[model samples]
Target: MWQDFGDYILSEAGDDPVKIAEIGVGKFDKISEILSEKKNITVLKTDIHPKDSTVIKDDVTNPNLELYKDVDIIYSIRPPSELQPHLINLAEKINSQLIIKPLTNEDLNTGRVKMKLKNYKKASFYILR
Candidate 1:
C-alpha cells in the first residue's frame, strides 16, 4: 500500500524536476523517503511537531505560505480529520495538487470542495487539483 502511494506520486511527478511537500508528516516518512530517492523530485516534510531535524516544523491549520511556494504537489498521509480542510485550503492557495490518504473508510472533511477519489494500484486516496 505504501509503495502504491509513492508510485502514484511519482507518476504525477513524471520526469520533470518538481518540488513536493508532505504535510502533517508525523513520525512516518516512508512515502517521503521513497519520493526523495528520485533525483528530480525534491521532497519537503512538514509537521507541527517534527520528530527530527529533517522534518520542518509547520502547522497545517496556519502554514507558512512561503514554505509551499513553487511546490507542485502537496500530500498528507492519514492527517487528522480537523486538519483536512486546512490542507485543501493550502493547496488551493498555492495552486498545487493535493493528495490525502485518510484512514481506512474515513471520509474527508473538505467542506464543499469535492476531491476525486483515486485508486492507484493498491492505494486509495483523494486528490484535489
Candidate 2:
C-alpha cells in the first residue's frame, strides 16, 4: 500500500518536483523513504511527538503554516479520529490535495472535507481533491 500510494502521488506529480507532507508520520518511514528516493519529489515528515530526529515537531490540530508553505500534497496514515478535520483544514488552507488513511473500519469526522473513497492497491483511503 505504501508503494502504491507513493506511486499514485508520484504519478500525479508528473515531472515536476512536488512538495509532499506526511502528517502524523509516527514511526513508519517506509513510504517517506520511498518517495524521497525519487528526484522529482520532496517529502517532509511531521508529528507532535517526534520519535526520531527525522520528523519535525508539529501538531496536526494547529499546524505551522511556515513549515507547510507550498506543500503540494498532505497525507496522514491512521491519524486519530479527533484530528481528522484539522488535517483537512490545513490542506484546505494550503489549497493542496489531502489524503487520509485511517485504520480499516475506522470512522472519519472531517467537516466539509469533501473527500472521495480511493482504492489504491489493497489500501482503502479517503482523498480530497
Give the clash count for each candidate. Answer: 0, 0
> Which stretches in model 1 have alpha-carbon errors above 4 Å?
none
RMSD of 1: 0.5
RMSD of each: 0.5, 1.1
Tens digits of per-residue lDDT for model 2 on 1-129?
778877777776678978999999888878788788889888889999999999999998878899999899988889998999899889989999998888988888987656899898877889988
TM-score of candidate 1 relative to the true fold: 0.99
The whole-model C-alpha lDDT of candidate 1 against the native structure comes to 0.95
The local lDDT score (0 to 100) that residue 36 gets in candidate 2 is 88
Error at 47, model 2, angstroms? 0.3
Model 1 clashing residue pairs (backbone): none
